[model samples]
Target: MTRNALPTLTLLSLLAILPCSGCQSSKAEIDRRAQHIAMLADDTLDELDAAVATGDVGDAALSHIASAKSNQHQIKDEADKARTALHGVEDATPWWGRTLGNLAIAGVLIALVILLWQTGIGFVIKRLCYAIGLLIPRSTKASAALDAEAIARRRACPEQRESIAARRASDPAYDAEFVRQKKRKQRDEVSRHALPKEHMEIATS
Candidate 1:
C-alpha cells in the first residue's frame, strides 16, 4: 500500500510540472520580446543623439526626454522622406548633366576672380591691407629720411623764419639767424613794391 501511494504522488507531481513548463516558456518569450523592443528604442535614441551632436536637431527637440523621443520619430520620418526625394531627384537627373553644371559654375567663379585680378583689384586689396595695418606704409629707413626732409623744409619756410624773429624780440639771443631772415624779408618786400611801380610805369609809357 505504501508503494502504490508513492507512484500516485509521483504522477501528481509530473502533472504540475508539465503545466508550468509551457507557462515558463511563454513568459521567457515575452521577456525576450520586451528586451528586443527596449534595445531597438535605445538604438533609435542613440541615432537622435548623434543627429543633435551634428547640429541636425534644434534646441527644442532636446529639451525633454518625452519630446526628444517624439523628435526622434519625426526626424526619422523626415529623413526617410528626404532620402526618397533625393533618390527620385537623382533618378530624374543624369549624372553627366549634374557634373557639367557644377563644373560650369566653378569655371565661371574662377574666371570672375581672374578678371577682378586683371582689373587692378589686387592693388585695392593691398591698399586695404595697408589701411588695416597688415602692411607697412613705408620702410623704416625711408620713413626716417622723409621725416628729416620734412623737418628741414619746416625750418627753412619763410613763415617759420618770421616766427623765429618774434621769438628773438622776447629773448635777444633766441636765434641770431632771425636777424638775417628779417633783413632779407624786408629787402624782398621793397623789391616787390618797386617791381609793381616799374610794371605800371612801363604800361603807361
Candidate 2:
C-alpha cells in the first residue's frame, strides 16, 4: 500500500476496534467479583485463627495456614503482574518522539523564511525602485536650449512680440512662419483682382 493509504487504513482500523474494546465488564460484575474475593479471604483468615485458638494445632491447622498463605501469595503475584503490565503499556507510548519531530518542523520553517528573504525581497525592492524613479525629474540640456531659442525669436519679431507677451505663446519660429504665410496670401489676392492696363490708363487720363 502507499504510505498515505497505510496510515489512513490504520486509523480506520483503530476507530473500528474502539467500540469492541470499550465494551468491557460492567460495574456490577466488577463489584461482585471484588466482594467474592474479599469474602473468600475473610473466611480463610477466620478459619486459620480459630484453628490456632483451639488447642488443635495439628496437621489440619497447618494445612489451613498453608492454604491461606498460598492464596495470599497468588493474589499478590497477580497484582504485581498487573501493575507491571500497566507500566509496560505506559512506557511504550511515543510522547517523547515529538521532540525530534518538532525540531524538523522548525528547520523547515526557517528554510522557508530564508527562501522568501532571498527571492521575494529582491523583487519587492526592484519594484519600489521603479516606482520611485518615475517621480524623479529627467530634464536634459537639449530641451532647455530649445526653449531659450524660442524665447529669443519671439522677442526679436515685432508682430509676434505682443502675442508672445500674452498669457501663453507659441514657439517664435512657428509664429514667424505663420505671419509670413498670411502676408503672402494677401498679396496674391490683391494682384488677382487689380484693374487691367487699359482701364488703369483711362482712369489716369
Candidate 3:
C-alpha cells in the first residue's frame, strides 16, 4: 500500500473504534471498581476469621461469591453509563458538520492549484516573448541623425570642444559631443590647408 493509504486506513480504523471505545468504563467506573475490590477484600478477611471461629467454611465461600457478583454488577452499570455518554456525543455531531469540513478542505486545495497554474504559465509566456524580441533587430537611422546634429552644435563652441570630446570618449551621454568636435576639427584643418579666395574686382576709389 502507498504511504498515504496506510495513514488513511489507520485513521479510519481509529474512527470506527471510537464509538465502541467510548462505551467502555470511565474514571468513575475505575474508581468504583477499586472501592468494590477493597470492600470485598475486607469482607473476605472477616469471613475467613468467622469461618475459622465457627468451624464452618460455607459462610466464607458464600461471602466471596457475593462480592464477585457485586463487582460484576458494578462493571455492567459503568459500561451502560459509558455507552449512554457516547451515544449523546455521536448525536451532537451531525452529518452536515462533516460535509462542511470536507468542502472547506477541497476548496483550499483548488485555490492553491489555480494560483500555481497562473504563476507558472504567466512566467513561461513572458520569457517566450522576451526571446522573440531578441531575435528581431530595430532600426537606428533616426538615432544616427540625432547624433550627427548634436555633434555639429558642440563643434561650434570651441571652448567646450576638448571637455566635450573627453566626456564623449568616456561616457555614453557624451557621444554627440565627440562627433561634433571631430567634424569641426576636420573642416578647420581642410580650410587651413586650402588657398585663400583671389581678389578679381577693381580697386576701390
Candidate 4:
C-alpha cells in the first residue's frame, strides 16, 4: 500500500467503527435502564399483590397501588425522554403506526400480524372481535377492590379531580348528563329502601 493510502484507510475505518461503537454503548445503556425499571416495578407490584391478598386493603392499600402505577408510568416517560435525547423521536417506536417496508425484504407472517395490530386500524377491529367474543361495553362488573382503587385515585390526585370539575363546569351537555345520572341513582336508592305496601299502610294508619 502507498504511504498516503495507509493514513486514508485508517481514517475511513475509524469513521465507520465510531458510530457503531456509540450505538452499541447506547443500546447497552437502554438495556440497563430497562432492567432497572423492571426490577423496581416487579418489587413494588409484588408488595402490592401481597397487600391485596392478605392485607386489610383499605384506602391505604388502594393509594399504594395507584402510586405504584403512577411511578411506573413516570419511569416509562423518563426512559422515552432519555432515548429521544440520545437517538431522537424517529428512533422510538411509533405510537399509532408501524412500518411495512421491512416486510418487503424480510417479511414474516408473525411480524406482519404484530405490526398490523400496532396500527390504528387493527385496534378497534381487535376489540370488536377478540379471542372470547365481541367486547361490548357494560358487559363486565367492577369488583369492590377496583371501586376502592378508583376512589383512592380520586382522593390522592386532587389535580385530576380539579381538571374533571373544570370540564364539567365548562361543558353544559356533560353537566346535564352528569346531573341526570346522579338523580337517577338517587331515585334507585330511595326505591330500594321504600317500605312494603302493607308496612307503609300500617305505619300511616
The candidate that wins on lDDT is: 1
What is the TM-score of each predicted model, taking all chains together?
0.21, 0.23, 0.22, 0.25
Kindly give the stretch of ten consecutive residues in candidate 3 with the minimal lDDT sum: 133-142
List ranges where model 4 is wrong by over 4 Å: 1-27, 89-205
Per-model CA lDDT versus the true structure: 0.53, 0.50, 0.51, 0.52
**Candidates in descending TM-score order:** 4, 2, 3, 1
lDDT of 2 by residue, 1-205 (tens): 3434544544554554455445544444444565566567666667767877897688756886877768865765564455445533422224434444454455555544555455587456544543433222234223323433454433336554454344124333333333443455456556655757657889899
Stretches > 4 Å off in candidate 3: 1-59, 90-112, 115-205
Model 1: runs farther than 4 Å from truth? 1-24, 64-66, 69-205
**What is candidate 3's lDDT per residue for 85-104, written digit by digit as tens?**
65444234446545554654
Q: Please name the candidate that would achieve the greatest TM-score relative to the true structure.
A: 4
The residue pairs found clashing in candidate 3 are 151-180
Which should have the higher lDDT, number 3 or number 4? 4
Q: List model 1 lDDT by residue over 9-121, tens digit each.
A: 44554554444333334334444555555556668898767777797666676677557688666665654454445433422334655555555555555555555566789
Candidate order (lDDT): 1, 4, 3, 2
Going through the candidates in the order shown, the clash numbers are: 0, 0, 1, 0
